[model samples]
Target: MASLLYRLGRLSFRRRRYFALLWVVLLGACAFAAVNAPEAEDEGFTVPGTESQRAFDLLDERFPGGNSEGADARIVFAAPDGRKVTAGDTRAAVERVVDEVGAGSQVREALSPFEDDAVSEDGSTAYSTVTYDAPGEKLTEDTKKALMDAVEDGRDAGMTVEVGGSAVDAGPEFGGVTELIGIGVAALVLFLTFRALVAAGLPLVTALVGLGAGICAIMALGLPTTTITLALMLGLAVGIDYALFIVSRYRAERAEGHPAEEAVGRAVGTAGSAVVFAGATVVIALAGLSVAGVPMLTEMGLAAAGTVVIGVLVALTLLPALLGFFPQAVLPRAHRAARQPTAAAKEAAGANETTGAKETTGAKETTGAKEAAGSRWARFVIRRPLASLLLSVVGLGVVAVPALDLQLSLPGDEAQPTSTTQRRAYDALADGFGPGFNGPLTVAIDAKKADDPKAAVAQATKTLKATDGVVDVSPPLFNKAGDTAMVSAVPSTGPSATATKNLVKTLRAEADRVEADAGASMLVTSQTAMNIDVSNKVTAALVPYLAVVVGLAVLLLMIVFRSVLVPLKAALGFLLSVAAAFGVIVAVFQWGWLADLLGVAQTGPVMSMMPIFLIGVVFGLAMDYEVFLVTRIREAYVHGERPAQAVVTGFRHSARVVVAAAVIMIAVFAGFIGMTDSMIKMMGLGLAAAVFFDAFIVRMTLVPAVLALLGRTAWWLPRWLGKVLPDVDVEGEKLTRRLGADPGPPARTTPREESVNA
Candidate 1:
């Protein structure tokens, strides 16, 4: 591996045009792929569990559920004070508002206190319900505003009004604000780190290609588009980032007077290994998410894994190819005199030593980066591996303590960003009536003669009382003279999922007892109950799902690295990083540390699916750094250097590039915390934790520290294992040796002993 990086690096110095032409070809292919990317079906999303979804066509007719599709919007009318109202003017004014809102005829059911039979029993405050029958399962803005304006017009008529419901009610306006922040921060860091207009833009170009491909692919696979769309953006960011680090390193070699071919080869040999490792790490980390047992979460895991794999490939191949197309004008002038960076230049190569390594004609030792980076990282970790590791351990421990406190929330359109009228209506009702008003659990009973007169309503009443969440159990009342029984169980407050689960537990238990006692079967189903069942089903399937993914990822890495331990060790590193990241999220967000500072209003437990998503995403991303760093070390080792020397040398060479890459990622992820969207903010915060830990703690300190500690065993493979395993030179060491002039072993750094006198 070491000889290959050295040789290809030398070859790049020897052959420039060949490499440039090759790059042009790859870019053209990716662009063609991008151009051919097909449009998705209706924004290209499919609802999950569609094949096995409960067949409720019968229920629709049976219950006619009188508009039970859930509320479309809620209109709130309040007086300035909280005092109960007996005023006729307040009522009249509210009626006028409701009339105006309902006048558009776009909605099916517009209910309000001002409307007949719709006023609150106390008449202290009022509300309006806006129902709709839309093609895409949501009311249009035209209808939403009519409802909103009715309330607004009432404000002038001595009533204060608010509108909230539907998608608008699901989340806050700043819901995706964190995403914007993360992307912005990432872009800024990319710009600063690369210090070249084209270089900075390179990731964007390849990422867009990969991302467009990912989107098209997933859409073609037929998955629903929801909050999970956030994954796409994140995937693109990481893909671009991974490519930027490698190509920039390669470009630096070119600027240093090496032919583009050798530079490309070296880039692939050292940074290429890193890319492979990062890809493996990502695959392992995300594969775990597949095991989380929730189909929704598993789907997300698959999507993320696919994106990383495909993205990395593009970064490695397409990005290098695109960079080869740059005109000679893009290369910096010879470094005899200082040169100011233009935006274009800055986007390609930051004025850092990462670019300067090329000045040695892509040679190592005197010019080798791994040794320098390794030494610097060793200085930090050797002195304080314990302290740094401990801080990560302790902080993560503190934060993850709340993971035990995590509870799942119900999913809804209202869970999306709330810029729509339905969301506004939902908020109005949640705020005006009660937070629980947004969602509640329903209990449905199935008996022998569901709607017949012979059904025993009294027995069902007794059955419901013993139910755990029998908060306000109602006596069974039959639609057709005591045949079918159904009751509604409204949770006192909060997301409906948990409350539904509890109610299902209580109902199922009582139903079992009744059946055993009376020899009659009954059915109990609720939104919450179904959701709980889904959770259980997902959990049951999580382990096997994870095993398949992890196994595959490990197999791929092992094949690439030709060492079982490398794959296994990388998996372990990814785990710690993810664990630490999760712990921080729990400590800060769930535990409510500086919630105001972060603008996280809800301190309730994170969504049930969040942990798996975060862990997978973080693990995959951190592996990116791991891959680059380890590859350099391995390359040095294959050069016949002793393992100890390899560790030190490899660390020096790979350290700075890894650090710079991580910093850019950290900035991008962290910057998104300030976005207006809550979910986007969560993503930013989680990624920020992952990136910070990967850079300062994992890649810089822990990884090098461990490799130094591991000696040759880090890449050990048994003779028998070697016989069975196919040798894969992800960098083609044999091919490199045969093809190029040797750059020679990197010159050893001047010792501190000799430096003082020099």
Candidate 2:
């Protein structure tokens, strides 16, 4: 890597513009390719007999001709006063909504109380039982704009019309807003950090290249995937991350008097390896979500992994090409006075460590230049390892106190953009109708083989009405082919609360009891049932996912560092971070701290599987920066430095880079909270906080201090085990240092390094 850096440096001195042009050509080609990218239609949500063949099979077997017991969307008409809206004004509004409902362009169908006897009796408000023609078809930008305009037009009409249903409430605008926030935040962070337009542009460029290439690749990869709101942000983040490491390295090389090309090569050789590993870590972490037992989550994992793969390749190739192209931009501005080393500078570089304040790196020549000037961090971590760890533990513990209060509700159109017609109708429904104004659980009792599905449904209806909060139940919506009857179960509370949980419990248990007494098999299934099953699936898979993540992290660390103790300590440290994140999630979301600040409905219960999900992802991210830091420390240790020296010194050099990268990510994540959807908001805040606290407080502070306390023991291994493991070059430093020391080589000097006549 060092040799590569030096050679590239030489090339930068010779062919700076050529390198720049090469990158320009390549970047243009990549972008052009992306613009012409083909679309891939993957299985997301499938309609019974549309393009998704599998969906048809499932529908035919499980829910043919619509499962009456399945969930349905509700649309309502309302007055502004928040009461039973039944004026001529409300009637006109209701008619307008109905007009849209039967349009077929907006959805599969919207069946309201006027259309279905199951909706409501003596209703001032109507329900729109909607189904979409294409569940996975993204609303195009123009369509979303038109929806927004139509809603404004309705308001102008002064009829007080609001339209919402299952498939209409949550539309594409929410997704777009979320993406915009992420991009804006990331852009702001990079601009602030870089301070120059070019420098700022560089990271964004890398992000665009990586994301564009990844999108095209995903389209071409023959995977069952479609574009999502989160896709662009995820791609940009990973891309910027990859670029940051290389750019930081380039800057470090410029400090060493190496040219841009050399820095690129060196950066690729060292930071490139770390980027690959970091990308892999992310892949591993997200892969755990594949086992979330939802086809959506499984698809998410695959798409996320595929994006990372594309990012890694573009980052490796295009970045180096860009570096070769823009030597002047890559290097810092030069000045005549700044050209010479100070008289005392040479003395500082050659000095050895002595009885001093604290030791960082044993490589005095390299280490002294990199330390954080006046770092209070070192004093705190080194002097009080246990205390630092405890502070992080307690702080995060307090934050997670809300995890016990977390809740997971199925994302719906009501969570969509407030500006859209669908979302407006949903709001209208909720205002005039009730909490289940959008979509309520429909419990179907399977009496398909029974002589009397009507009696069984009546029994199920009685059981549902007996439940404390169930507002009403349908008598029976009998299927022609099967002796099955569907019954609606509406609750007073929203779908992601303790009330929802209680409702599910009551419906299943009471209906089962009624069926047993009636000598019938009652299958209670609905939207609520699907949600219940999904939550249960997440719960079931949590343990295995966590085990895989932790075990793999430890093993990877062990291989990378060649010491069990080092990896063991690293794993424990990461575990601490995960626990801390969990505790905070519980405390804030479950317990409801500043939920208003977070913009959630309320803390429900930690999402049934949030802990497991957060653990895998945050652990891998924590470990990535950890490796980026510790591997350098290991390099110092391998070169005869003490473990304490390695930890402190390595941290001193890498801390700023890692922190800068982390700050950018935090910004990107935190911005997500600004989105309208409550679920996305929760996820945004939770992940943002986890990364911020973990990266800065836990990984940066607790990790270094603890390792310092352990001293040489942190790197200890049995002699026999050590003998079996071959030494791998951490930075190719041995050969570089040897070349520096060898008397056989000619003495090195450059035009910039020549001594004056004085």
Candidate 3:
């Protein structure tokens, strides 16, 4: 691993011009491809063999002409003075807009609210439903342009016009304000951490280059539906952090008196290796989403994983090559000349040669020169390992309490922010009809086996109406063939409410009873039902997915560190941090503790996909800090320092770097908290909180205490296991040997080093 990074570093420096030009041309090619990329299709995710899917299949088979593929668009209109919708003047305005929309292209059917009894009882609000000929996502750009023009006509009239529905509300906008905000935060963090303008800009420049290529590749592949915003979010976070890690190391090496080329090589050989491992862990965890057997999740995970792969490659190759281009700009001027002798300093050195020699000897004997500011704190924690352990546990425990009450469900219209027109349309429909009006369930019945198909339809309708949760049951509509009938039922509860979920289950149970009594096939299907089905499948699959990720991570860590306890400790701490993140999310979003402040609405259950995503992303990120911190500690341990002193020294050196990298990630993720979409906001905040806890509490505090408490046992592994496990040399110890600076033998029985203790 170290040899590969070292070779890459040497190659980058050797052919720096070619490397720079290669990246520039690649970026240009990707940009050109992005401009000419084909439009992506949105084929929504579904869990096969679920009841809702079964219902959809039956409907498609039995009723070929039914409105299954297309979605209805709702045009909401209101008078500026709040005049009654039925007023002659308001009616004329709304009718004109409705006429314009109906006359527009792609309209399969247009039902005026006035003629269709869709007006509110107070007559202040009315809407028109327009059904398109094709699926909402399949609408051509020309059709969208025409629709927007018709919408403009309504707005031009003396009315407040808003449109909502699948055709009009194409999810959330991606990579505009949110993307910029994230980049701004990342740039700020980098500048503050590096304290050099040019040094800070390097990571951002490389990261953006990598991000552009990643996004362009995604666009070119035309799998935009699976991962649009998410891919961008991760690409930015990982790319910046990956470069930051390598740059920090490179600067550190330069500060320690290494030449520019040598520093870059060692940095690449060491930190670059860690980046490779960390990035691979992330990619593996993300790609593990395939275990869920959902196409959308699979594609999204793979897409995001692809970006991380690019980030790793960019960090290893492009970053080194770029650094080589302006080696003087990689660090501060003061740092670059720290080891050089000036004229006056050289004369003073000659006069005080004996004094200078003694001072140098004292500095070599003392550890204070090498100790970081955080080392004192780390040493203090080591002294009171038990107390530190208890405190860290209690702190993480408090944050994890809310996770016990974690509920899994996909947010429906209720989850949409109130600012959106789709949400307003949802609220209008709920206000006029009922909450359930926005989430009607379709009951499909195959009654060809029944003695009397018409009678079976009547019986099922009666049964549904009699159900406790059913607020209204539409009259059964049969296919032209008379073999299939469908009924639409409005529940008494809103879609995301607990009562609505119960209602779904209740109706399914009753439908079974009806099917048994009438000898007909019956299935319940709806947008809400499909979401519930997906939520349930995701929830069920989460455990296995986690098991796979955790198992693989543990195995990988064990091999890398050659320690059984170390990996277990890391895995456990990571899980705790992840739980705390979820707990914070549940308290903030689900419990509505600070939903107003955070701009989160539609709070009921956390998004079903959130836990799955959090596990993969958060776990991978936690492993990043784990690898960074633990590998340093292991390096010290292999060099024969006592466990406690080794931890203090390792923590002292790696603490700031780990914390800085984590802050960059937190900034990148937290910047998206301002997003309008509740799901994206959740993801942003959840990831930020998870990284924070993992870096600050788990890595900084708990890990050191545990290692101190365990002593040498922390590095223990069975002889058989150690021999079988492949040596994943992340520390570049082999490179040290080749550099002729290898420390001979482990100080197995040497007295405790006084320098390490202080």
Specify the highest-lDDT model's number: 3
Residue 723's lDDT in candidate 1: 87
| Per-residue alpha-carbon lDDT of candidate 1 for residues 428-463, written as tens digits (9 for 90 to 100) | 555555555455545445455433333444566666
TM-score of each: 0.78, 0.79, 0.89
Per-residue CA lDDT of model 2 for 1-758, tens digit only, reads 34444444345434545655664665567557655656555443422222122323433465665632222344444444453334566555555655554563535555544446523333444554555454424544443344344445445555454544333334332245655667776777665544445555677787776676666555555444433334554676677877777766655544444444444555666666667667777778877776665566666566766677667766666666655544445333331134442433322221211101223335452334533531336545777888877786777666555444456655555445566656566566665557663456766566655567677667667777888887766666666654655566677776655677676776666655776765455544444455555666677777788778667767666656777777777677666666666666656656766766666554445554455556666776777777777776776677677666566556655666677778777777676777776555656676777788778877788777667777877777778876776544444465446544752323233333343101
Q: Write the per-residue lDDT of candidate 3 for residues 73-105, one digit (tens) a residue.
A: 888876666577788877887887778777867
Candidate 2's error at 536, in angstroms?
Answer: 1.9
TM-score of the candidate numbered 2?
0.79
Give the whole-model CA lDDT for all candidates, comma-separated.
0.57, 0.58, 0.78
- Scored by lDDT, model 3 comes in at 0.78
Poorly placed runs, candidate 3 (over 4 Å): 77-94, 114-126, 134-162, 176-179, 338-370, 741-758
The number of the candidate with the highest TM-score is: 3
